[model samples]
Target: MSERSAGLLLEARGVGKSFPGVRALQDMHLELRRGEVLALVGENGAGKSTLMKLLSGIYTADEGEFLLDGKPLQVSGPRDALEQGISIIHQEFNLMPDLTVAQNIFIGREPRAGRVFLADRALEAKAAELLDRLHLPLRPGQRVGDLTVAKQQMVEIAKALSYDARILIMDEPTAALNDAEVRVLHDLIRRFRTPDTAVIYISHRMDELKAISDRITVIRDGRYVETLDTATTTMPEVISRMVGREIAGGAGPEGVRDDRPVVLSVDRLSTKDLLNEVSFELREGEILGFAGLMGAGRTEVARALVGADPVASGTVSLRGKPVRITSPAEAAKHRIGYLSEDRKQLGLLLEQDVNANIGLSSVKERFQSFGFVRAKAMRARSRELVDALRIRTPSVDQTAKFLSGGNQQKVVIAKWLVKDCDVLIFDEPTRGIDVGAKEEIYRLLNDLAAQGKSIIMISSELPEVLRMSHRIVVMSEGRVTGQLAAAEATQESVMHLATLRPETETVR
Candidate 1:
C-alpha cells in the first residue's frame, strides 16, 4: 500500500446505492484520514443520509465497497457495524426518554451477575465509569426524558463511544443546540478524536463546518462533487460546489413604511409558563423577526398569539380591532396561521399527499360546498401552489414525507396561503434545510411581503434573522428585551439583547 493510503482510516470506493424509482447515491466516494473530522455537506435530497446509513450498516450498498484501514469492510446490521468499530448518531435522536442514562447507554449489553440474573448496580457502575472517563456532565441515574436536549445529545455520544468506535458519525449534532451548547458538544468531539479514530460530520450550518471540520466533501443530487480543505476553502465556495451555482449574498428586507397599516398587534402577551409580557406588531407587507436563545420563549410567543398555548393575560388586535383568540381554530377564523418549527410532527401529515396537506386547512371554507367535498377544486389549487412555490415534486399526489425538507416547508406555507390567512407566523422556517433551498424560501417570504401579507418569522439563526426581517424583536427569558430595525441590527447587537435579562435595562 502507498503511504497516503496507509493514512486513510476509511474510504468509500465508487459506492452506489439505490431505491425504488430513486438513485439515492451514485458513484459516491469519500476519504477519511486518521484523527480528522470530515464534513459531508449537500442539499437535503443530495443523499447524505443514504451514504451515512450505508456506512453504519443500516442499508447495504448496491454496488462498490467500503475499505477500513485498507481492508474490505463488511457488516450485517447496525449492531454488527458497532461491533466492527463504527457508530452513527442520527439527527433525530434514538434514545428512549423514559430510561435512565445508564440504562440507555448499556441497554442490551447490561452487565449480569450470572447468565440467569441481571445486575442492575453493575450496569449503572459501568455507565458511571464511561461517563467519568469521557468527562460527560451526566449522572447515570438521571432520567433521559428529564434532561435538556443538549444533555440528551450527550447521552447519544456517550452511547456511541461506549462501543469503542473507531469511526464516529454525527448527523446534524448542533441542529437543535444553542451557541453555548454547541461549544460544549464541539469540545466533546475534539476530546474524542484520536490517531486511531476519525469522525464524519454532516451539517448544513456553514459556520459550524469551519469550526469543527478539517476537510469538507460536497455532493449534489446523489453524486460526488468535490473535497476541499476547510482551512483553504471559503464557505461560499463550498456552498457553490454543493449547489452547483454561485449564491449571491443579499441584504435583508428594506424598511417598512411607518405609515403601513398594522395588521396584527400583541400587547402584554403573557403565558403561564416561559412567556412574560411580550409585545410586538406586524405591519402589512412587513417581516417581523423574533430572535433569542433556546427556551427564551420565541416559540411560546407564537403559540400564545395563535392560541396553541393558553395566555394568562394580553390583548390581540387584528386590523386595529380587538380580538380574543382562544384556540388555533379561532386564530384561523381571524385569518391568522402558525407554521410550527417541528413541521413533520405539528404542521404536515406525513402519510398524506401534497395536495391534501396543501388544501387541508381550507377544506371546510374553500374546498367544500353544500356538505360535499370538492376533490377537483383541491387538486387544481394544490397544483397552482406547487407551481407558484416551485415545490419539487413529480405530482401533487406524491406523499408529503417523500419530499425534501425544503419542499415540505413550502407545502406548509401553501397550506396557510390556501386558507387566505393574512397574518402568518413562521417559527424556524428554514431549520434543517440546505442553503440553496433557504435562498428560495427567503425570496418566497419577500414575495409574500410584497403581496401585502404580514409575516412573523422566528429563527434561531442570527444571520437568517438579520437577512430576512424588516424589524427584529429580541427576547430573553420570555421577555421582549429589545427591538431593532433591519439597518441597525447586527449579530453582536442581537446577541446582546438575546442575553439581556429582565433585571437589566432594556433596549427599545
Candidate 2:
C-alpha cells in the first residue's frame, strides 16, 4: 500500500445498498484517518444511517467494499464487526434496561468460572476496570434503568470501548443530552483519539459537528456530495451541501401585540413531583417559547397543563373562563392539544396509517357519525392536511412508521389541527428532525400563529427558542425564573435564567 493509504484508518469505496423498491445508498464513499474524527451528516433519509449500518455489519453492501488499514474488511454480523475492532453505538441504545450496568456491558461475553458456571465477580471487575480507565462516573452494580439519560449514554460509550475498538461509530450520541452532558461526551471523545484510533460521528446538530469533527462528509439522496474540513468550512455551507440548496436565514419573532386577547392563562401551576407554582400566559396569535435545561420541568409543565400529570393546585383560564382539566380527554374538550417530545411513543400511532393517525384526534366530533367512522370524510381531511403540511408520503394510507422522522412530526401537527385546537403545546417538536425539515416545522408553527392559534413551544435548543418565540419563559428547577421579549432574549441571558434556582429572586 502507498504511504497515504497506510495513514487512513478506514475507507468505504463505491459502496451501494438497496432494498425492495428503494435505493438506500449508492456510490457512498467515506474516509477516516487515524487520530481524527469524521462527521457524517445528511438529512433524515439521506443514507447516513444506511452507510453506518453497512459499516457496522448490520447491513451488507450489494456492491463495492470496505477497507481497514488498506486491507479488505469482512464481517458476518454485528458481533463479528465488534470482534474485528469496529464498534457502533446506535441512536436508540441497545442496552437492556432490566440488567445492571456490568451485566449489560458484558452480556454475552461474561467470564466463565468453569465450563458451566459464570464468573459474575470477574465480569463486574472487568467492567469496573474499563469504566475506571475511561473515567466514567458509573457503578457496575447500578441498575441501568435507574440511571439518568446522560449517565446511560456514558455507559454505552464504555461498552463500545470495551471491545478495544480501533474505529468507533457514534450515531447521534448527544441527541438526548443537555449542554453540560454534551461537553462531557465531547471530552470523552477527545480523550479517545489516538494515533491508532479514529471515530465516525453522526449527528444533526450543526454546532456540535463544528466542535467535535475534523472533517465532514455530506450525502444526499443516496449519493456522495463532498467532504470539507471542519476548521475552515462554514456550517451554512455544510447544510447547503446536505440539502443541495441554500437555506434562507429567518429572523426572530416580532413582539406580540398587547391588544391581542389572552387566550390561555395559568396561575400558580404546581404539580406534586417537579413543577412548583409555574405560571405563564399565551396570547392569541402568539408563540410562547419555553426554555430550560433537560430536567427543568418544561415538559412537566406541559403535562400538568394538559392533565397528563396530576396537578397539586393551580388554575387554568381559557379566555377569562376558568376550567378544570383532569385528563387528556378533558384537555381536548377544552381545545387544548399537546404534542409530546417523544413523538414515537407518546404522539404517533406507529402501527396505524397516516390517515388514521391524523383523523384520530377529531374522530368523535368530526369523523364519527352514528357511532361509525366517516371513512370518506376522514380520508378527504387527511389528504388535505398531507398536502398542506408538505408531508412526504407515498399515500395517506401508508403506515405511520414507514415515514421519516420529519413527516411523522407533521402528521402529529395535523392531528391537532384537525381537532381545531385553539391552544397547542409542542415539546421538542424538531428534536430528531433534519435541518431542512426543522425549517418546514418552524414555518408551520409561524403559519399556525398567523391563523390565530396560541402555541406553547418547548425546546432545549436556545437558538430555536429565540428565533421562533414572540415571548420566552425561562424555567429553572420547576419555577419560572424570568420572561423575555424576543428583542431582549439572548443565549447568555436565557441561560442565566435557566440556571437560576427557585431560592433566587423570581421574575414574573
Candidate 3:
C-alpha cells in the first residue's frame, strides 16, 4: 500500500458478495487514502458495480470489514452512508427532470419554516451556496431537465458537496461529456481534492484514467488484481491486469479490398441540430468508422441513415439509385438496420425471450402467415442464430434481461441478420461489455463483413475506431472534418479532425 493505514480514509478488507448464480465479488480489498484519486478499473460485470454498491450502502458485504477513519463502519442504508460523509454519483443522473436543482439537492431533507410549512427560499439559498462554492455556473432554480448533461452532472456533484462529503465515488463521469466538458469535470475533481477528502473514480476511458488518477486498482472477474501508481505504471500493464491478457491490436485495413463496389452512399446529409451536409460512401464488405467526441453528430448520422431520426435534406443511395427512408420500417425495407448504443432501451425487449427479439424484425415475413404467427418456425430459426452467434443461454426461451450484456448485444445483431439486412449501423457496439465479449463481437463483425455486409460503426473510443475501421470519417461540430484511409489514421490525426470546428477550414 502506498498510503499508511493510519491515514486511510476508507478501507474494505476481505469484502465478498454474490448474486444468484454469480459471485460478483470475492475477497476484494480496497484502501483509499486522504487527498487522493483512486481509479477502479475492470471489464463490465467484473464486480466494480457490486463493490461500489457495498461502499455506498446500497448492498451490504456478505463478508468483510469496512473501516472509516480508523474505525469500523456501520452503514445500514444510504442515509447512514450519507450521514457518514460518503456520497456516490451514479452513471445515470438520479435527479428528477421536472425538479429544480435546489429541489433535487435537498429533496428529503428539506428545510421547513414550521412543522406544516415549506421553506423554498432557504432551499435555494443553500443550494446556491453549494454551487457557488464549487464555482459552477448554474442557477439553483434552474430545472434539471433544461440543463445539458455536463451541467446536470455538475448538479450531482453539488448535491454531494451539500452533505460535506469526505469520500466521493464517481462512476463513468465523462461518459456523456464532450472533450471540453471533460476538461471542466477534471478541473472540478482536482478542486475537490482536499487533504480531508478521498475520491474513488470508476471509468473505462484509459486517457481520462491516466490524466486524473493518482493510483489505479484493477479488478478482474470480481477479484483484486493489483494497485499501481498511475504515474509509474504503463497503460499496457494496467490493461493486462484488468483483462488478464494483452488485447491484440490489428493492423490498419488488413484484408480489405478496393475492388468492392459502393453499397451505400450519403450525399449532402443534414439534420436540424446535429448533421451538416455530411457525406460518405460505404463499400460492400467495408467497415467505415465514424469518430468523434460526444454530440459531434456521429450518432445523429447513424439515426438519420436508418430513419430513426428525420433528415432535413439528404440523398441516400443504395447501389446506383436513390431511396427515400422516412421511418425505421422504411429503412428496413431498404435493408438498413441500426444497432443502438443504448441497447437495453432501444435494441432489445428485456421482458421478452431471445427468440422473440431475434425474430422481431422479420416476424411479418418469416413467422406470419394469413395473420397468424408460426411459433415453431420462429423458435427453429432463432435457435440457429443462437448457435451461430454462440450466445450463452439455457435455451432460446431465456429472457433477454437475464442474459449478460454481451449476449444481449448478440441478440440485437441476430435481429438484423434475421431481417437479411446487408447494411448495418452499429453505434458504440461494445460499449459496456467485457473484454472477452468485445473480442467475440469483433470477430462477429469481421465475419459479417467477410460475408459482404457493409457496416458504418460509430464509436467514441479512439482505439476501437483505429483498430476495426477500414476507413474513418472524423466529425466535429456536426460536419465531416476529415476522412482517412485506415493505414494513415492515428489517434492524433483523428482527434485533430474531431476537434476542428465549423469555423475552421472545411476538410471534407
Candidate 4:
C-alpha cells in the first residue's frame, strides 16, 4: 500500500456516500501524484462526479477521509478548494458571459486602484500573459459567451491557474471541441504535467485516455476497481474494467457495419462546413452510426438534416422519397428528430417540467374539445414515457433542469419519441453518462432500431462506433474520406481517416 501510495500528493481512501435508497458511492479510493494525469472513468451514476465533488468540497464524504499531501484535510466548497490550490473546470464553465476573459479570470481578486477602481487594463495584461503561457490564443478583453467552446474552456483553465491550483479537475473538457481545439487542450494538459501539478482528467473517450492519461482509474457502481498505467494497458482492458465484462456482439454499436438496410438517404449534400457533396443513406431497423474524428462536419450534416442549420445545397430522401428540410419544424413534420450536442442550450427547456418537455413536441395533439390541452392525458403519456425510457426523476412534474445529464438526455429522447419520428439523429447521445446508463442507452438504441426506427448516430467514441454501427462513415476536414462495412472498420483505419490531411494533398 505504501509503494502504491508513494509520491502521492493527494489521496482519498475508502470514500463512501449515499442518497436515500441509492448508494451513490461506496469504498471509493483515488490518489493523485505530482506530474501525473489520472483518468477517472465509470458509467453514468458510477459516482465519478460524486467522488470528484467530495475531493473538491462540492459534497462532503459520508464516510472516509481525504488526505492532501498525505495529511488529512477537509474541503468546504469551491472557494475553499480554490484557496487550497485545488480547482475544477466543469463541462458547463462557470464564467460570466457578460464579463471579459481577464475580468472573469481574476474576477474577485481584481487589481484595485486605491481599493476602489479596478485596473482593468492591467488585469487584461495579466490575463493575456496567462493565456500565452497556456498556449491559448484568446484575447483577454473578449467576452466569455463570445468565445468558442474550446476557447472558453481555455479561459476556465487560465482562471484555475490564477488561483495557483496545484490539482486541476477537468470534466469532459473536449466534449464540444473540434479536433483542432482538442489538440490545443491536449497541449494544455501536457503543460500541467510539470514537476508540481497533478491533473485529474475525466472523459469517456478511451482513445484519449490512452493518449493523455499517465494512469487510468476505473470506478464501477461507486467502487474503485483498479488503476493501470497507460503504457501497460489496452483500451479493451480499460473498457472491460469500466464495464466489467467482454461485450458480446449484437448488431454492433451504431457505428459498426452489419447487414442492415439504408433508411434515410442523403444524396449530394453540401453544407457551410466540411460537408462537401456529402452523400449517405440510413437504414430502418439498424443503428447506423456516423464515425468521424473531430471537425469531420458530422454534426453539421446532422444540423443540416434537421434544418437546425442551413444547407448550402442538398437533396434528402426519406425511404427514397425526396424531401426539402427548410427548418427543424419542417424536418419534424417529416418524422425526423434531431438531438443537439448542446442539449442544455438548444435541446431542452430547462425551466419547464419533464412532462412539459416530453409533450412539447406533440402538445398540439393533446388538444381536446375547444382547443384545450388535456393535462391528464399529457401527464399519463409522460408517465408511460418515464417508464419506457427509464428516466430518473422524482415525478413527471420535475423540471428538466433538475434531472441529471443522463436523465435529461432521456427526456430529450422522449420528446422525439412522443413526436413518433422515424429518423432520429442522436448527436453524442451518451456524452456524460456513466457506464451503466451508457449500456442501457445502447440497449435502448438497439430497441429503437429493432422497431424499424432509423437512427443516425453521431459519436466520437470508437468502441461505440465499432460495437453499434452496421456501417461506418469516416469524415475528415469537411468531407467523407471513406466508408467501411463493419467487417472492414478498425480503430487504426478509422483514426487514419480521422487524422487531418492538407487540402493540397490528393485522396486515394
Candidate 5:
C-alpha cells in the first residue's frame, strides 16, 4: 500500500451475497486506498460483478460492512451512490444515442436559466472543459450516435467525471476498445489517480492490469484469494492465484495439423470498408484461431464468408471447387454454419423452445416431412443433442431464455451439429461463460476436431487463442498481417501482428 492511502477511501469486509441458486460471494474483503487503482480479477462467475453492484448500490450485501473514510456507509440506490461520489461504468454504455455529448454528460442536473429554461451554452462549455482536461478530441456538440464505440466510451467516462465521482468502478472498460483506444483509456486512468479518488479496475486482460493497476486482487469461486502489488508480482503468479492452479503448456489436440487436408479456403476476400484482402485456410479436423483487437475485421471476415455480409471481391473454395455463397441458406447448403458472438441477437430465438432453436437450421430437411413438421423426429434429435452436450435443461420444450449462458452456448453448438455442418465458425464462443463451462466448451471443440470437423474460432482473449488454435491468423485494420503455427505462437508475437497495419491506414 502507498503512503497516500494512510487514510483509506473505501473498505469492504466480510461481504456476502446469494441468489436463487447461487451463492455469489461470501467472506469477501477488499480495501481501496486513495489514489490507488485496485485491479479486481477473477474468472467468469467469480462474484466480481456482485461485489461491484453492492458497492454501487445495485445490490445490497447480505452481510458485512462497507466503510468510506473511516465511517460506515450504506448506499440506498444508484442515485444515492452517485450523490455519495460512487459511480460505475458497465461494459455496455448507457448514453442516449440521439443526444449530444454535453447533454448526455449533464443529463440529470442541467444548468438552467431561472431554473426553468435549458442553458445549452453553459452545458456545452462545461462539457468542453471536461473533454479538454481529459485530452479527448471530441466536441460537446457532437451527437453520441455519430461517435465511434471508443469515443462513446470516452463520453461515458466524461459523464462519470461530470458527477465529480471520487470512487469509480470500471468493469471490462477495454473489452470493446482497440489497441490505440486502450492507450487513451490508460492515460485517462492515470489522470484519475489522486489523493481523494479510488478506482476499481476489473478486466480479464492481464496485460492491461500490468499497465494500469497499482495493486491486484484475486477472487475465486466468490471468495477472496489474495492481493499482490503490481510492480512486485509476476504474471504467472497472479494467474495461478486467480485460477487456483498452474495452467498447462499444450492447448489443444496435437499431431492433427499436418495430416488433415484443407477444408475451406478463402482467397483475397474483401468486404465494403470492413475487410480488405482477408484470406485464410481451414484444414479438416483443425481449429484455426483468429486473433486480433476489437474492430480488426475478424468478425467481419466470418460474416462475409458465411454470407451474413456481402463480399465485394473474393473467391471461396470448399474442398476443390470454388462456390458462390450469396446467403446464409446457400452457405448452409454447403455444410457451413456460423455461431455468432451475440447468441441472443443473431443465433437463438429467446422465445422459442430448445427443440425449435436446435432444429431451426435444418428445418427443411430434418424436421419437415411431406409439407408437415415431424415433431417426434425433432424431439428425438433435440433430446440426443441435449444429452450429448450435457445441457442442463428440464426438457427440450424449455425456452432458450431460461438457460444459463453456458447452456445457451451449448444449444447454439447443438444447432450447428444438428445441421451436420462440416465447417463451423465460432465467434467468441466461450464469452460470458464461467470457468468450468469454458473448459467444457474447450473439450467439445477438441472432440469436434477429433471427429474431422474443421472450426474457425475467433476470440479476443489471447490466452484462449493460444490454447485452442492449431494455427493462428492475425488481422489488423482488415488485413491479414501474419500467420503463425501453434507451436511457435506466443502472446508477444500475436500482439505484434495484431498491431501491425499499412502505413497509409488511419485508425479511427
Candidate 6:
C-alpha cells in the first residue's frame, strides 16, 4: 500500500490525551494501511501508551479525532472501539484467572442456544477451532490460571481475534515470550494479518521490531516524531530518535580487577530441572556475565544460587567457605542477593511505598529493634539509597507502581543494598529500562564492583555479555557450554554456545 491518504486504513490526526497533571499525548498522529505492520516505539511513559489507549478507546481523546475507513468515529469506550474493529492486546494482560479459554473469549457475549440460555458447548467448540487455527496448543475448556503465562497470553490473542478486529494493537506481546515462543507468535501475527487487518506492534526489542515491522513510528515525550519504512530505518537510527541521542548502554564497564580474590564460587552446582553441574567463580571486584537464550536456565541458576530455588545437589561457596542455603532468607544471611528479571512480579511490590519495598526483605535490621519499625531511621536509609541510586522521584513515600520503569528498578536495587549483600546477582538488569537509566545502572554496577563487591549479571543481550563481564559463562538449555575471559570473548562465540543444546542440561 502507498503512503497516500487513499491507501490508508487508519488516520489519527492531532490526537491528544491528559491525566491529572500530565499531558500524555500532544499533537500525536499516526497512519496505517491495509495489511501493514506499524511499529510504535518510545521509552516507557513517552506517550506511546496514551496514543494507543486513545486508539483502543481505553481513554477518549481530549482533542482531535481518528478516522477509520474514511469515516470519522467517536469511541466512548473500549467496547465501542472493538465494535469499530479496533482491538488492543496490552503489555499487562487483562485475563480472568478462573475463566476457561472459551469463557474468556466470549465473556460479554456468549452464544445463546435457546430461551436465553448459554450455549457452553458451542462456545467451547468455537474457541477450540480458533485455538487450532492459531496453533495455540490449548484447549477451550482449560482454565486460564492453570495455563502458563505464555498460554494465557495466547488466550488473550484469541479473545481479540474473536472480536473480528481489523486493526490490532499489540503492546509488547513478546515481552514475556521465550525465543522459540516468540518465533511462533511472530509467525501467527504474520499469518493473522489479512488484506484488511492492520497490525500496530509496540516492542522494546529492536531486533524483533526489525523482524516484524513493515513501517516504524517513533514518539518522544508526548510528541509525534516520524514514521519510516522499516526496511529503510536502522535500529541505531530508531534509538537515536527515541532517546534523541546516539546512546548505547548495553555494554557496561570491563576488566574488573583481575587479581582480586573470588568472592562467590559455584563448583559443579546442580538443581532439579535447572542447573546441571554448572561451575563458575565470581571475583570480589568483578562483574561476571552469563549469556544464554531465554528458558536456557539462566535465571534458574540465579534463583538456586540466591536460595530462591533449592539446589538438587552441588556446592556453593562464599569467599572459600562452604554455605548450606535452602531458602532465600538463608542466602541473604550468607550476604548473597538476587535481583529478579521480572521486577514487577518477583522483585518489587508495586503497590507498596518506596521505603516499604526497600525495607521489605530486612525490616528489623534497617529499622532498630524498637519492637516497632523506627520510621525516622527507615526514611533516612531509604532516602540514602534513593539518592545513591539517583532514583527519579518526588519523595520516598511514592508507590513503586507510580514511579517510572527506571525509578522502580532503582527501588529494587536500593532494597538489596540495604541488606549489604556481598554477592549480587542481577538478572536482565536493564530489560525494560530506558537508555539514560541503563547508563546509570551500568555505572552503579561498576561502582559496586570497585567497592569490592562480587557481581554475576545474567543478560540476553550479546553486547552486554561482552562488555561488562570480566569472565563470560555461556549456557544452553541448563548446562554451561563454555566459559571465556573478557579478552577472549565475542558476540558470535557466545551465541554459538547459547544455541548449542536443545534440551536443558544440568549445571552441577
Could you give candidate 5's per-residue lDDT for residues 1-508 as a string of tens digits? 4564356899999999977556878999998988999999887667887899899898999999998887898999989999999999865577898999999988988899886899999999989998998777789999998675557778887888767789989987776565666788888888777989989998867788899999999999789999899999987788888778775444554535466798999999998877887777889999999988867888888889888888899899999799989888889999999998767657899899999999877888888978998889989999999998778677898888656555788899999999988999999887655454567688888988889899999987788889999888998888888888888889999998888874544321
* Selected candidate, larger TM-score, 4 vs 5: 4
Score candidate 2 by TM-score against the native: 0.90
Better of 3 and 6 by lDDT: 3
Model 5 lowest lDDT segment of ten: 248-257
Model 2 regions lying over 4 Å from their true place: 99-106, 109-155
TM-score sort, best first: 1, 2, 3, 6, 4, 5
What tens-digit string does per-residue lDDT give for candidate 6 at 180-294? 6678888988987888888999888888888999999999878999998899878889989988878754544656565788888888888877678888888888888988876
| lDDT values for all models | 0.89, 0.88, 0.84, 0.80, 0.84, 0.81
lDDT of 3 by residue, 1-508 (tens): 3438778999999999976556878999998989999999887667787788788888888998899987899889888899888899876567888999999888898899999787999989988888877777789999998665557777887777677788989887776555666787788789888999989998877788889999999998789889999999988788889888788755645636778899999999998877899999999999999998766888889888888888899898999799888887888888899998767758999999898899977989889999999989999999998998777677898888766566788899889889888899998887655555677778888888989999999876788889899999999889999998888889999999998987787675
Q: Which scores greater on lDDT, model 3 or model 4?
A: 3
Model 1 has an lDDT value of: 0.89
Off by over 4 Å in 5: 1-6, 93-155, 178-180, 225-246, 251-259, 292-294, 322-333, 342-420, 430-443, 461-467, 482-508
Which residue runs does candidate 4 get wrong by more than 4 Å?
1-8, 11-36, 57-65, 70-76, 96-155, 161-163, 177-191, 194-196, 206-276, 317-322, 366-399, 481-484, 492-508
Error (Å) of candidate 2 at residue 199 is 1.2
Lowest summed lDDT across 10 adjacent residues in model 1 is found at 145-154
Give residue 40's lDDT in candidate 4 (0 to 100).
92
In candidate 2, residue 340 scores what lDDT? 87
**lDDT agreement of model 2 with the native:** 0.88
Candidate 3: stretches off by over 4 Å? 1-4, 92-163, 254-258, 352-411, 503-505
* Candidate 2: tens digits of C-alpha lDDT, residues 1-508: 8888988999999999876555778988988999999999998778887788888889889999999989999878899999888999876567888899999898898999999998989988999998887777799999998675556777888888788888999987877677887887898889889999999999889999999999999999888999999999999999999988887879987999999999999999998888888888899999999998877888889989889889999899999999989898999999999998767757889999999999987888999889999999999999999998878777898888767666788899899989999999998888777888789889989999999999999987888999999999999999999999999999999999999978999875
